[model samples]
Target: MPEQVKLRDGTDTWVLALEPSDRERLVAGFEELSDESRRQRFLAPVSRLSEAMLDHLIDDVDGVDHVALVLFAEGPPHVYDPVAIARIVRYPDLPDAADLAVTVKDDWHGRGVASALLPVVIRRRPEGVTRILTEVASDNPASLAMLRRLGPTKISNTTPGVWDIEVDLTAHDLPQPIPLAVVPPEELDGKRLHPVLDAPGRHALRTRDLICPWLN
Candidate 1:
């Protein structure tokens, strides 16, 4: 679920929400992102999301409930657009403090975007989310290094060159995090917004997609 939020970073941060209506654009951008050879080397394919799917997800996305942050960077005058960024998705079966999955644009790598977002995520760390988690391809040293800088994280091999890492947010005195807008508000002017929705089995379906056809 996406939410409209304002964040204070000793400065100010405004994050726009990704409502259901933005499904096609969001999914399209995600597809484009995944298509990047650079990103493909590290991650798996992301299945194109449909409007109906988005509706189901957002309808039940309560802030402290099942929420996902779609972060993007902004331009001057507070224009929110794609930010080289990260996101947190909360799963009911998983531990409380949701796990984080981040992707920094190749061009923005090492520019402090990940660092900036981490503290915010830690601050807005959900009430029950004490630990944040993410998976990095074994070969991705840069990501591993950044994760290390964040704090204490448990590492376990998921596959030959893939690993799952969990970061303890409580130990880190991080500031509140806000969702960054990937699309501008003025652009959303008259777009039809759908109720956030997804198939109950879509997650499982995604797993199949990852191993079988493999969206990555």
Candidate 2:
């Protein structure tokens, strides 16, 4: 099932777990990415996703060791068109952390698509996942900005124009308790729910027992 998410612009988008049947949409979305976007995401200047890579992505949706989610519009004609994807894959040798990656369609850049989708992925963090790590090209300021919104990040420039960032999920304040139901419009008032990206913000709500602190 798809869940409705509210963007900072007050528009609605649907977030769903990627499935094998979504191969066509996923491919189409990746094909639309620009050269720079592709490089920032895959760390390579590739024009197309290989068959093996596509298969690995679609087949790793167990929602445990591998968690992936895609954001898309629900309107007709483009309902299945993926606007962005966020995924976290655990390392067998490094049990306490996972590598994270997020990519938004070029047309949807700067629209908070990644901001909205990231919280969804973080809420679904699997057991034993203490930290999330990602590698970003130094030139990719947009990707870096998105990661900064989560919290204070530990960044290392191991190589020229490449940075590795690590974020400790438990470093933030504990979330305030809220009902695990659809948030009503009245509750959406400024005082009712705090912005998820605000440092030290405590407002949060639950869905299916998963607490999403940054949904608002």
TM-scores, each model vs. reference: 0.59, 0.74
- lDDT tens per residue, model 2, 39-112: 66655566665565665666555888887777775435444555777777765556776767777767777878
Candidate 1, position 66, lDDT: 44
lDDT of prediction 1 = 0.46
RMSD to true structure for each model, in Å: 13.5, 13.4
Q: Write the per-residue lDDT of candidate 1 for residues 1-216, one digit (tens) a residue.
A: 333443343323334333445444544444544354233333555455555545543444455544334455444566555543344555556546454545554444555655665555555555677665555666666666666666655565544555556666556453332221332344334321211112264343222111111111
- Show the colliding residue pairs in model 2: 196-214
